[model samples]
Target chain A: MMLKKVVVCGVGLIGGSFALALKAAGAVGEVVGLGRTQASLAAAQQRGVIDRIASDWADALHDADLVFLAMPVGQVASVLVSMAPYLSSTTVITDGGSTKVDVALAARQALGAQCAQFVPGHPIAGAEKSGVAAARADLFYQKRVVLTPLAENTEAHIALVEHVWQACGAEVSRLDAEDHDRVFAAVSHLPHFLAFALVHEFAQRADSAQLFGFAAGGFRDFTRIASSHPEMWRDICLANRSALLVELDAYMVELMRARVLLAGADAEGLQAMFDTARTRRDAWLDGLTPPGE
Target chain B: MMLKKVVVCGVGLIGGSFALALKAAGAVGEVVGLGRTQASLAAAQQRGVIDRIASDWADALHDADLVFLAMPVGQVASVLVSMAPYLSSTTVITDGGSTKVDVALAARQALGAQCAQFVPGHPIAGAEKSGVAAARADLFYQKRVVLTPLAENTEAHIALVEHVWQACGAEVSRLDAEDHDRVFAAVSHLPHFLAFALVHEFAQRADSAQLFGFAAGGFRDFTRIASSHPEMWRDICLANRSALLVELDAYMVELMRARVLLAGADAEGLQAMFDTARTRRDAWLDGLTPPGE
Candidate 1:
């Protein structure tokens, strides 16, 4: 199915890449950019990520077959409220929000009956860099895109979102909104939180420079996510706080166990844990499609 | 000053790379390999990481100008005790142990008066892959090699160690043994522990498969160190337990603060911490020399 006009709100890495991917797939005729900044929209247009920049929700949703919300999670409620009146019945809405439950709540509260059109999604792809300049058509290639369909969403509307993600070279799967948030809080948000906390702790130390000076490849990779967008991660942490707290507490228990092992010099126990982690991680890595293939 | 002969114990990634680097720099005449396994030593010899596989400490240390102990931290004490009888008065010794204080103690207990000849060092360079096969002549190129010299170490002996690391294209810096352990416990060891704990915690969960399936780039990098050599890390953690425990406890405090911020939905506080972390990490990354230069 071809989308004659697709409106992408945000015009940054996620939105711009989505627009470019759809155009490259020859599945979208025109991509309209809508965002908080006209300059960023102009940047997306210049980068060929969007065919045009929309000045208002009225113009953006006019004849739009799909509307993608790709902004930070915290902005979803207000943006949905602003665009709700302009959304046509046939215009299926989806999002690239990392947290699904919060975005689903925002859509339900804002769109009311039209929330049926909103299929909450999260594309499991990112880079160290962000913004329109970092956007690439192949960003979603071989990546996973999870959809958390609301009870109000019709099969056809959910299928439309799935088709769009598939057309962009992504593998699509569905999960309940609550399950989506909980799983991601355990896998994604919790790790990001730990990384940020570790880095921040080191940065606040008196010998931070000396400590960082000795940090090598392991330290580099382990804390790489600490370099992610602060406001974006902050929103995610707060949005998925309950699930994240559960993860954080579980992790603390694990760390405490590790400390006990270290304190008692339990070499066998520590090695067992590390071995299990490595074995599982290696198996998962082996199952993945290597990038750039 | 070129080495007439160099003996490397435990010819794995760290030791194998050192032999190769020294050979590439024409800093040593002959390299002798000594390890617990003859098979690995033979493999190192076949890869040209060592000129010969020595049958004993006497065979390895005979006429050797330097002895480089590159074994796991747990093996160092026993190895030092084994080699102490063969060590000549002028044979300056060094190590690539990740922990300094423990290695220092090992040297003192095993070598006694000969401890002055041992210059404790840690090369801040590593890859996800290990073993002699993964060794490269350029492994230490542009990397940091920290020397934690003993009070009894003569300036000339310490200079010889520094010059050798420099010949391998490393920038050598000196820190007190105590300071080295403390700094590295915070920067390097703590991050690895956290990564391993995070991965192990998830791997043990009932929903492990689901959580891992939804995991993305952030999770990948954050837990990359979880795939490290389990035995090696266990030894490092145990050897440097005191300092690592301090760092780990401090990090838990930081994580607790983060939890409070999330629980309270204090968006401003969470963003501030993330901002600080990202800013510091970005600056640290900027100051690093780009690899392969």
Candidate 2:
């Protein structure tokens, strides 16, 4: 059997890491990296993440069986539509965008019947750093990657995408685009929003540097996501505003309850609140116990 | 040189760990553990965290030049006042309490002229787990142990406490209790508050089990503090409420602004907000690039 030819567009962190994973799994015969920056394309090739580099998108996709649009979430639509001119009807298109609803919608409008081959995906793995320079082959190992497929999606197309993810060592789950958005809004978007809000608030405080100086490991890790790409996050928050807003309100109500309990010096009530949380979260930890290798 | 005799009261996590640190450093000739529980005292001695277990408070203070009271902030003053009956005028006492302002004042009212000898200290090192069994010799290594000593504190007393921290491999910083409370309110208490709020908000969502399943590394680390000792945290939140409430107000204001920005889909404003936080916190990461061991 001939190996699949894989093309990764916008060879930054996500795209570069995916290319590395595909090559490592021996699932792809050759990886072609296409990035806007000529220097970045060279960097990706130099890192051995890709066998070849293409400065132009069409050149990279010319003989590829799979094309991955790993650009910023906001840029996924326009880039996908732009690639429409060079796309073969048989080619399988996939994305690793953070926000899925918009990307899934874009696939429908841009590719229509061909959208059956476009699998919208989101891998819940990242570091604060960005670009191809920060790419690692094992970034997606043991991570959860959610796929949002419409009724138009064919089983063969889904199998091809699922095979790639399995080869990359990801735990794959399928859900509707709207459900994906709501779920991610709680787990991912709210966290990023809180992280951004926290550090930004401290930056504007009088003793900003000193405040950061006193910050220990917990604070650093908690706020690390605040250091992610602003352009990407801003697009994510706007795209999924209603869901994010609801989670935000829920957090506020809980916080005020704790605050009021503290104000009254109700030690018993406060301890009970913490006890309940610890019990619930401990159950979660036990379920995923020992962590995946 | 003769090793100093040291007594650690309430041999739970903090006291047991302190005794272990002191004994490991060879700073104490005889490390004695005193607590309310017989099982913990037995574990402390069996683990070599203490040379012997002292069942009575008066007996524990007999030959000690130094004493460390490692109890909740709310209980620190009463314990000191009771133990004062048997303490020698020259024997210096210290505490591992979270809030120094109240403890310092309590020392003043209870210890009177002996307040100069009761140094207020807090070691900012801990884990989710507590008890004598969890005690380790290296717990305080490379950790910060802040001392809040008043003007009446004699040089000999302050130096004695500083020497103990140095022996335990802790970096010691001396600051006024009020400033200590203000700084920690932002760095420690506020993060706990936010973590508790987040866990309560999302961990109780409709699909909490799945959200917990997909929670990434960052989320797990950020929320780990929510699993801390509830009774202990209740005392921390209440004793330090004045400073913590201020920090809470500041955070809520920032959250309000973030809500408006997200609600209005203000892309540029949100982008700027995230960008500034990224630059600021990334600088923190750069500045504290961990020193080679």
Candidate 3:
């Protein structure tokens, strides 16, 4: 086996799925799920997502060669701090947090001299569902996994983390933590926030039922992300506050421009804007081969 | 056949699909395709979306029992005005325009004394694809078709339109022209505009390629409507200006509130907003039995 023992913290969709993928690839000797809930860890073990359950990181870390923090962004720092006391000098740590800048900082603060082993990462794959029950071994297949290795991280540590992701059938790429935060804030975080806002605004309306009744496919697709886990999104938004704010402002500016065009009845101008977007979006869609395709 | 002859003006996706659906139901004696271009007309005829091509509405209306103006919103008025001179007193008229208020007003002005036969409708069915080639007989199956009958419309005309839609396997409902415009502006037009704006904004960014490269399924689904026909959306926006402007302002207000919440790092408030949206969206999705489900 590539690793003697690997611990997956949180044991939810991302954690469970990662553990299962690692086991399927035979990349580890033993996969232990570490979570706050015994029931969830038990479920993960029963489903073969993990070979064993870790009641606490200390016990799990004693013989572990690798650690994966697949928990919510809000809890990543505290967990890192708690486990730092037990982490072996040879063990490598990586995370599946959506925001990297804060996560990298948290690892640095929590692990101190051992920060070189902690690699901040985000695997861009998910569904509306959550929990260990929703986990699958193929969840990361053909998906993108971005790693923002800290300045303190050694080349060997980075390679080990990248190796795990590659074995899981994910395309791995590296970016600076700040750059990762900015790009994802614009593409992922902002869109999720806007979707939630759209749904909330409609629900607050007096004719909400009528408005929702009239909403068709477009509305459904546009707001589908609004159905995501609330606490997860909340943590993402708060963790990547500055970058998300910048993106939100940029998006607001675009919305205002559209509003001006509509208010002025500028049909030609509106058509030009929509045409540009259509052409670009179509080209982008043509490039992507979705999973089933 | 329930009807002696039916003429489908424009013969694009909506027009062609409607014609095919009616034909599949054996609801019409002869379906004639009318368009500005002979290529499109011939394409529709070859695809069996229509039985024959009409060189002009004058000849097409001679024995027509019904006429469907399935053109862009901007052309609906002119087409109705052009066909008015040849419309028989017994001929019933309906349109598949996205906006209702303007179409209803146009029909009144164009048809004059014959306004009683015109019904304005907005079918809640479509895809990113256009043209007769993309048309399908089952496009409207299990979809909602909203009709905004003019004050001058006769009960018989309304019944005929309802019967035709029902024959197409659509759930038909009635709404006032103004209310229809208001609700659709909020749900449809606003969402389309926002999606287009999002794509336009991102495309204008210096790192657009990288931004798009990292976009996941949520981004794809949210902006899927951005690939819609530009001219079609332009006409809808212009035709429904007043209501659209009102909805846009309301949306801007909501956006600004979100901005404030984010700027202040109000985690509790943000979570509350996201939770509300998640609950409502989940409920709505649970209620829907999507196509083929």
Q: Which candidate leads in lDDT? A: 1
Name the 10 consecutive residues with the lowest summed lDDT in model 1 chain B: B284-293
Docking class of 2: medium
Model 3, residue B248: distance off in Å is 1.0
lDDT of 1 by residue, B144-261 (tens): 8999999989999999999999999998989998998898898888988988888889888899999888888888888888888888898999999999999999999998988888
DockQ (0 to 1) for model 3:
0.88
* Model 3 regions more than 4 Å off: A289-293, B289-293
User: What is the C-alpha lDDT profile of model 3 across A1-293, one tens digit per residue?
Assistant: 38889999989989988988988898888998888889998988998889888767778998788999988899999999899889889899999999998998899899998999898899999887899999999999999999999999999999999999988889899999899999999889998998999999999999999998889999999998998888899999999999999999999888888888888999889999999999999989888875434
- The models' CA-based lDDT, in order, is 0.91, 0.84, 0.90
In the range B158-248, model 2's lDDT, one tens digit per residue, is 9889889878888888888998899899988898878877886666678887678667766776688877777778888999999999999
For each candidate in turn, the TM-score is 0.97, 0.96, 0.97
Which pairs, if any, clash in model 1?
none
Q: Number of clashes in every candidate structure?
A: 0, 0, 0
TM-score for predicted model 3 compared with the true structure: 0.97
lDDT of model 2, residue B87: 82
